[model samples]
Target: MAEVHSRSSHRELRVQAGASDNVTANELFDIEEQRNRLSRMFCFDGMGGALLIEPSFPGCGMIDAGKGDLIYSNALYEIKAGDRLFRSVDVRQLITYSALNYVSKRFQIDSLGLFNPRVGVSATIPVDDLCAEISGKQSSDLFFDIVAAISSGDISR
Candidate 1:
């Protein structure tokens, strides 16, 4: 079993192309939803060592509008690994994943909450594994093997 780490449940926010009368065009506001894949999260392990996963995991995400305004955004998520909130295992995964997956692909991140002070990053792993590692029942070595296959020589960079 995976070790239980810190956990701080946060609300997921999604900004639509057009702003409503209640909210200003550039003003930040809070809204609630049960769950949205665009802003959903998954963990690799039990907060021990994990990464954050969203719709644009392998790409820097953006919300484009027909007008001149180009809305760029990324999901704000917090992971709880250990005593540290947002600066532990998940941090490396976020940096590694973002670098290897999105940055390597030339995806742009409008803003990041990985190590922001404003947001409380819970260092706990989510129940799901976006990579399907759990269901596959593959050991760590096997998982790395799969990663090796998927990444090939590109992962070295």
Candidate 2:
């Protein structure tokens, strides 16, 4: 999934993904080893829910059109293969995607989630709860503020 990382930051990943040796290739095999388990961890009820991989939502202001890791059922789960637990960047990524979806009205995103296969851990929170916990604002108000801020040229990048 394309999180908010710069191109240069993925140079090593590009090399790792394309590495010629067997050991390195096996070392970078996240999909082969982690996909099903991580999806399950994200509560991706293999049969019941709609599973969308790399979903793109309508952009707002400078956000542009962006694709998230995936959305299973109604929850948007940001999949991370990092060595540790959830990070701030992970939460920001979900919030940014949610804000984008907030304006897009693409689908009913009732919950937000973070999953790390590397740590075998996952966390999910309802949309309003996440917004309230982060900013003490309802999701609608928080999303409106973000759109207004970006549209008003408040952010440089």
Best by TM-score: 2
Q: What is the Å distance of residue 122 in model 2 from its true position? A: 0.4
Q: Rate the local accuracy (lDDT) of all candidates.
A: 0.34, 0.75
Q: Residue 52 of candidate 1: its Cα lDDT? A: 30
Error of 1 at 44 (Å): 29
Task: Write the residue-wise lDDT of candidate 1 on 1-157 in tens digits.
Answer: 1122222333345666465666764343323222232233332223322223332433222211111101113322433323344444554454334333333433343333343222423222222232333345323343344445445544432
True lDDT of residue 5, candidate 2: 23
Off by over 4 Å in 2: 1-21, 24-32, 42-47
Q: For residues 1-60, write the lDDT of model 2, one tens digit per residue.
A: 433322222222133455455556556666445755654553344345656668887788
TM-score of 1: 0.26
Q: Which pairs clash in model 1?
A: 79-122, 79-123, 80-122, 80-123, 80-124, 81-123
Top lDDT prediction, candidate number: 2
